[model samples]
Target chain A: MDFLRRLFGGKDNSSSSAQEAKKRLQIVLINDRTDISPQLLENLRAEMIAVLTKYMDIDEPRIEMDRGHDESAVALIANIPVLRIKRGAGGTLEDRFEDNPDDRSEGKFSPRGEPPRNQNIKSRRRK
Target chain B: MGARVIVITSGKGGVGKTTSTANIAVSLAKAGKRVVAVDTDIGLRNLDMVMGLESRVVYNFIDVIEKNCKLNQALVRDKRVENLYLLPAAQTRTKDAVSPTQMSELCDQLRPDFDFVLLDCPAGIEGGFKNAAAGADEALVVTTPEVPAVRDADRIIGMLESMGKSPIRLVINRFRAMMVQNNEMLSQEDILDVLSIKLIGIVPEDDSVIKATNRGEPLTFTQNSPAALAYANIAARILGENVPLLQLDSYHSKGFVASLKKMLGF
Candidate 1:
């Protein structure tokens, strides 16, 4: 298993077996707490990342499974970093700054349907 | 008006549910409250043995429910502790012999007479677990700070909550503080974090506990072991006492461990 992990570039969870058990347990418990499978969660994360990547420069997207309780419903938690937007051709951040200086929306990553999104498209003339 | 039937359960076997039931019952009765500890494991009954009331169990819990004997007739009084009783399970019969509703009704019938009624639940989330959990208004989920145990505890806690059982508290059994401190075992905080339940108490892994069980005595007998003190604290907390949690590592376990085992005749 160690050889396989090293071969596959898999990071070891922990050295101590007890802490390993705890780490494994936390993951297993989260899975057991919800009906959703880890594979499905991974897929969800991937799909969401793909959707977000198309609109903005997202860095270090992470999905965390936080259990509020054993009895309560499971909640999905995600954190995505938006560096900047992928604008139209010749719509680099520098060009946008030159055309509309002090455009707060320029080079900023904004969620779809938000105010900054329209402002971003207006100055860049991107769809 | 009636006593609260709190079922002591662990989804996995050999995690010390019966032991917890016996010690907690003894602690409560010693504190001057009327207590009855029922062994709901049916075929594999051991609570009677743990309470040292095995010989006195003339009529089992099934006998009372089936009308073979009166409820009081089947209840075996503890020899050492006053106001403490044991309702032994029928070792010869299977869990299928008793139904969930029947167990619920039995607890309901015994409620008004005692200050607290405790059920020693069997392992697994099957029929026996359902029957044991049926009558209880509260639950005490027992688990060791291990992977398999915590996983089962999580499932059991989920089931109990879905069943509408209120105030489910966790009791971490057989904890080894040194192992946890060295990161070779899961810490109490880690277990609680994963399980996400209110921690009632933590019983340290003590050598005296094994001796106590072998002698058919509850660990709380000598009050010498950290486990014994832990059980007593759990009982006190159950009574709404403002007892602080025991710091296991600081219990002077170094030299105290040797002296306690010797004094306990282990």
Candidate 2:
């Protein structure tokens, strides 16, 4: 048991030392290729989320900015939700008329009708 | 017999291409063979510095090509070793100063006088690199254990293959055995697995290397330095001597019994 402990312990120490060297090299190369630092990547991530929020309803938790294999490029991936009018909500008087069975004979909902409230909420969330 | 021209190149910068060229050139020269090491980096030449002949360069490679001086005028003889010469690159001129035809012609001229002509190529796959590799009969790809360097080396190998060059050898430099033992650094096996080329030499990171370079001396001059010894062994290997790869870990590590006592509660 003593012999085994000594042998394995030596192996473990050497293995860890090698690991540290590898980590240092990987980090140094990543920083060398990309002018952006780790802190900058975090700041960029925050700013990216803010900009993406202005256009559409996004699942904030799902948004990610990843470094490329070359370390010279950045990738922005976001899940944006498209906004559309709700079937029934507080809208223009035309929407009430459109909802009426009698108005069914006419074409789709009138342009004056308010867009869906849920969509309005989504857009307002962006603000 | 005509000398074989081999260019050591890497697409990525700081991957020890110049160092490999210098060491290999010194190794070949030590074997009593006439060898010439050419620095093709032009504006950013480091081969002369690595070979400890930077100050001795009176006429640059550009002078030879432009007919400003004779080839012998540009060649700098090493005082430490006989039959070893350095053809330095011009610090004032850029890569565009030399063409592939001129480089090929230059190598052809040197072939009759020397047993080996090693070209120290510059970083990047540009005009300078093309010029350095144009007339080479073979190539030595130098790369670190890192992924990016390995990738760049792979691209260089591909380019050499496209140029119909064969029997290219791979030299893995700045290897840390401790890191490899810890599973942190890429092993020689890993690099060979990716490159799939004949292994020529594996050089460990030695502090003596920096010290030797700082003094403008190649490591091969110092018998006490392991790095120098490694270079000597590589030179022997190049001369068809089967020298075993230096096991750095085993040399540095304490005995197994001592390590075992430390592991136990004793």
Candidate 3:
């Protein structure tokens, strides 16, 4: 069924509505799932900087929650810089992605391990 | 056996949730199954207008929940289809007027008499959505080929999953075959891949849908229109029938041409 549609409908309009919708939906859904709205993330980042400055000397802290290939296991990887270590929790947030974020054995988010998403667009534009 | 409670919801507005609820309920009723569609979008109710039962709506759903009227008294039977009915939402009251417990209890009361109870969930994953989804055994999430609707549908599907709803399905509405063929709109496969849920229906973009809404008619009859054909197919699928989706390439042009030739005796 798909083979037939691709053979006929896939010939012209390779940039068809079908492909556009899929790409747009992927980005939009990933963003929604990640729940890192730009405004909200910005406010959190500001607060994190302010609260951290009150405690100790720190470098730039980047809060990035990247959407992995898997739909459910989006990652929230925060790079918090501190000159001194704090005592309390034994394990760290840095090693969280070592295990599967979701129950799926297949690692959901590549955590800077997988290939980038825009390779297709970049190649298409070059052509 | 008790009726199957199915809720039709789309987190985003203007994606044919009410339209699908009305038409599918009518189609099921036309097929001899007793069906009642509940309008849960109180205050911004459109199901009454879409089903063309606005004139007959004396008692809304809130009335029944509030015990102001009997359940049957609030139910408006369709003039065109026997055994098909509507439980309308209140025009003045808000969605908060009805609780999840009340809605589910109402559905339980209607279960023995009907084969299907269709709940029309309001737009957004807020109070109205929870109230409508509360009584449903399954969910039919509606979305268009656009990005925002798909995004919201994904969110709604996640919410449904968290609520432990089984067999969540997708209904792609306002689909343009030409756009899909041209790679301009999202195809069924693309939507399925992104949403990763089972697709139950794919309705084509037809002007007749708007016309039917204006006339308070549902496009679920055996019409030449593609949208009606899709709805009829969906209605059958909902009855647990093993129906395959329309073979697009053949049904789009070749089948029509062949049927036309047969009609002309050429």
- On TM-score, the candidate that comes out on top is 3
Weakest 10 consecutive residues of candidate 3 chain A by summed lDDT:
A118-127
- Candidate 2 — which residues are off by over 4 angstroms? A1-127, B247-266
Cα lDDT tens digits, model 1, B1-266, are: 78988999989999999999999999999899999999999899999888777878899989989999999999988778789999999999999998999999999989989999999999999999999999999999999988889989988998998898989999999887667766688888788777778999988777877888789899776776778888999999999998977554444465766564344333
Ranking by lDDT, best first? 1, 3, 2
Model 2: chain B TM-score relative to the native chain B: 0.91
lDDT of each: 0.81, 0.74, 0.79
True interface contacts reproduced, per candidate: 0.85, 0.27, 0.91
Q: Could you give the candidate ranking by DockQ, starting with the highest?
A: 3, 1, 2
The DockQ of each candidate is 0.33, 0.11, 0.36
Per-residue lDDT for B1-266 in model 3, tens only?
Answer: 99999999999999999999988998899899999999999999889899999999999888987889999999999988899999999999877898899989989999999999999999998899999999999999999988888888988998887787878999999987666665677778888888889999888788889999989888875455778878887999998888877544543466666574343222
Which parts of model 3 are misplaced by more than 4 Å?
A1-18, A35-75, A78-127, B249-266
Q: Rank the candidates by TM-score, best first.
A: 3, 1, 2
Supply candidate 1's per-residue lDDT for A49: 72
Residue A105's lDDT in candidate 3: 29
Clashes of each: 0, 6, 7
* DockQ, cand. 3: 0.36
lDDT for residue B69 in candidate 3, whole number 0-100: 94
